[model samples]
Every structure is written in C-alpha cells, then in structure tokens.
Target: MMDAHRQNRLRALTTPVVLIAILLIFVLIVTATGDKSLARMAAQTLIRVIFVVGLWIFVGNSGVVSFGHAGFMAIGAYCSAWLTLRPQMKGMFLPDLPPWLASAEWPHLPATVVSGVLAALIALFVGAAILRLSGIAASIATFAFLAIVNTVYSNWEGVTGATSSVVGLDRYADEWVTLAWASVAVFVATLHANSASGLALRATREDEVAAAASGVNMYRHRLLSLVISGFFTGVSGVLLGHSLGVLNPNSFYLGITFITLAMLVVGGIGSLSGAVIGVLVLSVLIEGLVRFERGVDIGGASFALPSGAQEILIGIIMILVLIIRPSGLTGGRELRLPVLGWRVRHSKQEPQSTN
Candidate 1:
C-alpha cells in the first residue's frame, strides 16, 4: 500500500506529466483542424503559458504580487531586436544604440538566450533591493519598478523606438517554437517547485516570521525565484517579438499584465498545472469571443457580438470563477492521475512544502 501511494506521489509531484498531456491535446487539435488562424491562436496561447508559468514561479511560491514582470518582457523583446536585427535596420530605426549593439547581429537562438540572460541579470540586480520588502509593500515596489521601466522605454526614442513599433524583427517563433519554450518553462518550474529554494519561499509565503526563525532566507529565495521567473518571461517576450516581426513597448503593459494574472489566479496559483491550464482555458474563451465578434454563421445567418463584448464576457467569467473557487480551479493541487479506487487531493488547510 505504501509503495502504491509512493508511485502516485511521484507521478503527481512532477509537472512533466501535466505538460505532456496538455501538449498532446493541443497538438491533436492543431493537427485535426489544420487551420492557419487556429494555429496562430495556438501559438499565442502557448506563449501565454510561458508567461503565466514564469510569473507563477515567483508569485505562486512567494505569495508576492508582481506588476513588474512585463517590464522584463519588454526588456527581452528589445534585447532580441538589438541582437537579431540587421545592422542597417538598427541604424535606421535605433540610431542611439551603443556602437557595438548597433553592429551586432546574431541568430535567433543566441539572441533569445541573451535576451533571457539580460533580463535575469537585471532582475538579479534590482531584486536584491526590492525582495527585502514583503506583502503589499513589495507588490507596490514591483509596480513602481514596472512604471519606471515602461516610462523610460516609451520615451527613449532612438534605443527603443519610443512609443512607435520597432519593425523588421525576424519572424521565427511559430507554433512549434513556442511549444518548445513552454515545455521548458514547465519543466523548469516543476524542478524548482521540488527544490530547496522553492520550498523555502513557500514557507515564507505561509508565515514569514516562522520561516525566518527556521533559518530560511526569505529574501534570497524570493530573489532567486524572481530571476528564474524573469528569464522565462523574457523568453516569452522574444517569442512574441519574433511572432509579430515587430516590437512595441505598449504591447507589454497593463493589458498583458492583468490578463496573465487573472489566468494564473483562476487556474490555482498554488499549483504548477494551474498556470498551463489557465492559459489554455482562458485563451480558448478569448479566441471564441473574438470569433463571435467577427460573426458566426447559424442556419445561413451571421450573428455577431457587439464590438467590446469579448472583454465584458471574459471579465464576467473571471468574476464567476473567483466567486465560485477562490483558490482557483486546481486549488493548489498538482496533477494526479487516478488509479483504480485511489483518489488524490491536496488539503487546502495545509500548505504543501513543494510549492
């Protein structure tokens, strides 16, 4: 009986099973439909999986709300532009870039990596200062950091193209590439969740005073999670830039920030599977609403939703989910496949050590 229980724990404790299942489902749908528009939507959803999962790495474990990750996304997007754009295009569009950056052109692989690294470095440097705070104060500091980043990027004309879209980015992130990164995000997140740092952070999230008394360095764990989260968020930004063949500071602002958070919370911020499932469910709903707005054919007549109905409808859904399940759909539980008569559940009152 103990061995059977142990096997279930091993199976449910890791994130790869959930991710693989999700991937298989997504691929099956894409294959069956073979629709270009649907494929594009899938790519976008996968990208969101990366974003929400990365955000989960920090926010889920630390219990700290972050409005600053989008800034890291913007930084990553622009960093990709700096590394991957042709020299001539950089001269024309980003004249004020330092001399070396202006001439440097790298392939998508290296550029994507560098973009993530740069964002992680920035997170490391800034998080050392910011992670010292806790609760709402820490959340506010992150928001302030985000505001500062957005303000600077929006106004820096030559380096960031200011408020204008930076065109000529290479379109390299198709559905497959996005899937690869999303898988990486899931794997990394799961690994960290089972690691010492993730557990330490979650301990602090539950009771900071107790955790600190136990010799768990709250600040260090939070900073580490922030850096890891920043890296994956940065990668998502690079994928988005390549998908659109353009970079814009506004794209990484509040709109993306709020929606991602909504997804994370609705799916269960306490579980790794929550991040992936949230993106999948919410993205499908948004895309469906978009299609309805474009008009749907029913018995030879086209019915269309009003222009802004999608937002309103999605907002209602979010509210309903929050009201119905405050802890989210997964309720802090990992993926546990049922075996015969055995049932699996996470006790809500008891916080799991593997966050």
Candidate 2:
C-alpha cells in the first residue's frame, strides 16, 4: 500500500520519464542512421521542448497569455554572447560594452546560469508592475513589453549589435546538451506545478475573486511564476545562441514566439504532457514538410510542397485543432505510465457562470 504522497510523486514522475525515453529513442535512431541532418533536427526539437515547457510553467498555471518571454530570451542570448565571447572579439564586435563585459569570457554552462538569473531578476521587477492587471489587459501589457524590448534591442548598437546578427558564439548546445536541459525544464515545471504556490496560482486562474477571498495572494504567486518562467526561457535563449553560433534580435521575436505559443496551445495548455507532445508532433510535422519542400517521391512520382507551404499547412493544422478540439489534443490530461497502474487525468473545469 503506497502512501498517498508517494503515489502522487510516482504519477508526477511518469511524464518526465516517458519524455526522456522518447528523446533517447529519437537520438539513438538518428545517430544509428548516420544522418547528420536528422541529428540536427532532433537537437532543434529538444530545444523547442525546453522553450514550450518554460512557457507552460507560467501560462498554463496562471492562465495568462505572455508575449513578453521572447524579450527575456533576447536578453539571455545577448547576455551569453557578452560572457562567452573572447575579450578581443567582444571589444572588436561590441566595442561599446562596459569595460568588464568587453574584457570577460566564460564557459557556456556558467554563462547560461548567469543569463537565466539575470532574466529572472528582470521578470521579478517587470511582473511586480504588470501582474496586477488581469484578463486581456495583462496580455496586452506583455505584448507592449515585447515590443519595447524589441525596439531597444533592435536599435541599441552598443550592446545588441542593433539589427545585425552577432556571431562567433561557440556551438556547444548539441543534441545531448539540449536533451539534458529539456529534461531539466520538465523537472522544474513539474516541481513548480506540484508546489503550493502553483496550486494557489491555478486557483486564481480559475476564479480571481474566489481565490482572493480564500486568502490566496494572487499578485505574489503570479510574480513568482513569472520569474521562474523567465529563468528557463532565458536558458533556452542561451542554448539557441550556442546552437546557431549567432544571435539576432529579430530571430527571437515574432516567428519563434508564434510557433512556441502554438505548440503550447495545440498540446493543451492545462497539462505538462501537452507541452512536450505538442513540440514533438509539430517539430516532426514541420521537418517533414521541409523535406517535401525540397521534394519527395511517392510511387515513383516526384512531388513537392511549394516554398512556405510548411508554414501555411501548420497554420491550417492549428486552426483545425482549435476548432475541432478546443481543449487540445491531450484534452488537458497529463501523461502517466501504464506500468505504474496510473491513469492520465484531465484538469477539472470550473462551472460556467452566467454573469
């Protein structure tokens, strides 16, 4: 007879375990195939897993839409570049950086840690000012934050290279590295979701007035979740910089934001399993379409999707998913291992109020 606490822990553990298993299989098959392109795609998918899970930590629990995470991501990427680039290169490329930054260099892991912490700190302050707002206004505020960050990063030549892409970053975030970090992201998100604050935040998400009346500190929980969310979001950005060996403000802006949010929504915003599954399904779909765009042969006949068809098709898929299953593909249920005798459970919905 397992204790209730122990049983709950086992259930929570299954989602991450299943995800790790899937990633292991992906890496093994790709490596065994000796296909470098497939290996690269696998690495990219792992990174997206990290990004989507990070968003889930904040958006799913708080039931708030955030368009501002990309700003923190940009901060993280540029910050990593400042720390990891050789002093000589920094001085040459980012000449206007502060003397200490221009003359300092650090390894990827340490730089990533520092970048996450800095982004979290920024979120703490920003959330303090904005998390008080509720509903659509809060969503609009986040969009404003993203716009402001983009404008500054796009024009600030001294630090972010303005519109030019910053290069020379070490390509250290390979498949294994991204896999490890993506695992960490899931662990962090699960732990947070199981914590007291996460529950209190979700309470507010269900009914703000009821939660506040019940003594939940809505503002505090929202701010804490935002800070935690910013941390992982920033780490993902550091990984992005290393993976691509460059940084561009525009790269972290609209395109990445839309795809990531789409993944989260398509996966079911209420479950961690949804976040992981969404990334895997969409990544594979997009990759397949990309290959088809290059051309495909079926039954000895050549076929190809036009350029940009992948984007258009993905958009259609997202719309159909939303129209057909608004609760998402997971129906808001978390994944569990059958060997554990645990069944996936959907989130309980609040009764609709006619008010």
Candidate 3:
C-alpha cells in the first residue's frame, strides 16, 4: 500500500518536473546566446501566458466561455497608454480630455495598476448584467460586449484615436517583468482555484440548479471570476502596450479575440496547465514559422506559406485537439512534486511484486 502510494506521488510529480526543466532550458538558451530578439519574444509570450491563464480562471473554473476578455485588455491598454504617454503629446492628440486625466503623467508601474483597476471595475459592472444568463446566452452576451467595446474604441477619437494607432509610450518590459507578472498571475489563479468561492464556481459549472439548491449563489461566484480574470488580463494589456510601444484599436479586434479563444480551446478549456502549454506551443509555432525564409525547399520543391498562415495553422490545430483530446493535454491535472521516500519504496516493491 505504501509503495502504491509512492508510485502515485511520483506520477503526480512527473509533469511539473518536466515543465520546469523545459522552462529552465528555454531561459538558459535565450540568456547564453545573448539573443535580445528571442528574449523579447519569450517575454511577450510570458505576458500572453498570463492573459490566457486569466481566461482559464473564469472559463475553466465556471465552464463558461468568454469572448469579452479582449475588451478588458483594450480598456487596460488604452488606460495605461493615456496615463503614461507624455502630457504634452496628450494635449496635442486628446485636447478635450478631462482636467484630471489631462494633467496627470504617471509612471509605468502605477499606470499599469490603474489600468487593471479600471478593467476590474468595468468587469464588475458588466458581470452584474450578464452573469445571470446560462450557457450560449452568456457566451453571446460576452461576444456582444466585445463588439460594443470595439465599436466604442474605434469611434471614440478623443480617447482612443478613432481608427488610428495610439503611439509614443515608454517601452519598459523585459524578461524579468514578464516572468514576475506571470508568476503572480499563476499564484492568484491557483489560490482562487483552491478557494471556497472557486469550489462554489466549480459547483455552478457542474450543475447550476444543484449549486443553487445548495445555496451557492451562481451569479456571485461567476462575477468574482470575471473580476479576477479582467484584472489579470488588464495587466497583460499593459505589458503588451509597453512591449510594443504603440497601440491600435484595431489590434484588439475580433481576429485577436478569435486567436485567444482558439488558444484556450486547443489547450483544453477545462485545464489551466493545458492553457499555458497551448499558448507556449502555439505562440512559438506561429512566431517561429513566420520567420522562415521565402524560398525554403520542401520535398524537392521551394515553397513558403502566405502571410496569414499562422492563423490558419492555429485553427487547424484547434480542430485537431478538439477531436483528439477534448479534455486537453493535462485533462485538468496539476503539476506537483513527488515524495522521495514513496517513490523509492515503490521501486523496491515493484521488483518483489514482479518476482
């Protein structure tokens, strides 16, 4: 029995160990080669990992799909951009702004935090209106929210530059910043997943009527997840805005929303670790494939994919994953370390059992 328990412990630890080892290898490769470009790519990928993980927080736990996360991200990007861009530039570009917004020039960190707060507030308001819906209704409502936000940002020139790109923000993102934010996001998500509220949310996901019968307020739990997801997604937007040093309303358009949703779906909508791995794998593939030379030879012939091939590839992958592993790679399993004594005893017992 002890040996069986040990084997279980070792099995539990294997996934996490492999993931950590791979992460460390990636870091070492980027650092040792002095590749700033690759490092930047890695940083951006980590930031996005946080954003996808945020999606998992709500959609994974509650089993409610959301397409409005991009709206929260847009809110954060614009808020941070407005706050941190030079005052003089704002005066030129957005002269009709409110006195407080026009007068203040915030540092990057404070601006990022404020952006997150603004997104959270918006999410709270929206959640109150939409969380009462079930299944497809909720999903459609969230998509409508994204459309509304996109329209507003596109037409609201004074605040969002209308259709033009917003420019001239300080660039302050690096690997350390990306990793720190990702770690915080992971910690928060894990805590929430293990919390009482999380349990209630999960119960709601399993059976809303049953959960309600048990006195679990489904709306309240769903709202909580939405707020948390919005907060982290907002932070991700800040990182993205800073990393790019420019922003555009169109950048957060439906294409982006679809791509993100695809990532979550392919990674396993029910699994957080699956979400992270899916983002890592897909992001790398998409970005890396784009760098291939135009005339590369394949099967004795020269060929190159079109500019938008990555998106197509992602869609295909999503379909395949859905068909083949609908539960996701990890199937909602968490990575954990093994107990050494358990594994050693299990190994010894395995030989005796074989004899």
List the candidate 1 regions with Cα displacement exceeding 4 Å: 1-9, 339-355
Give the per-residue lDDT digits (tens) of candidate 2, residues 309-355.
99999999999999998988899988878756443222123345697
Q: Give TM per candidate.
A: 0.93, 0.93, 0.87
User: Residues 1-355, candidate 1, lDDT per residue (tens digit)?
Assistant: 2445565546655457667677768967885798988988888888899999999999999999999999899889999999999999999989999999999999899999999999999999889999988889989999998899899999999999999889998887888899989888888988898788988999999999999899999989999999999999999999999988988888999999999999999999988888788888899999999999999999999999999999999999999998999988888778755542143334223455785
Q: Model 3: clashing residue pairs?
A: none
Ranking by TM-score: 2, 1, 3
Q: List the candidate 3 regions with Cα displacement exceeding 4 Å.
A: 1-25, 293-303, 340-355
Candidate 2 lowest-lDDT run of ten: 341-350
Could you tell me the lDDT of residue 232 within candidate 2? 91
lDDT of 2: 0.88
Q: At residue 75, give the lDDT of candidate 2.
A: 84
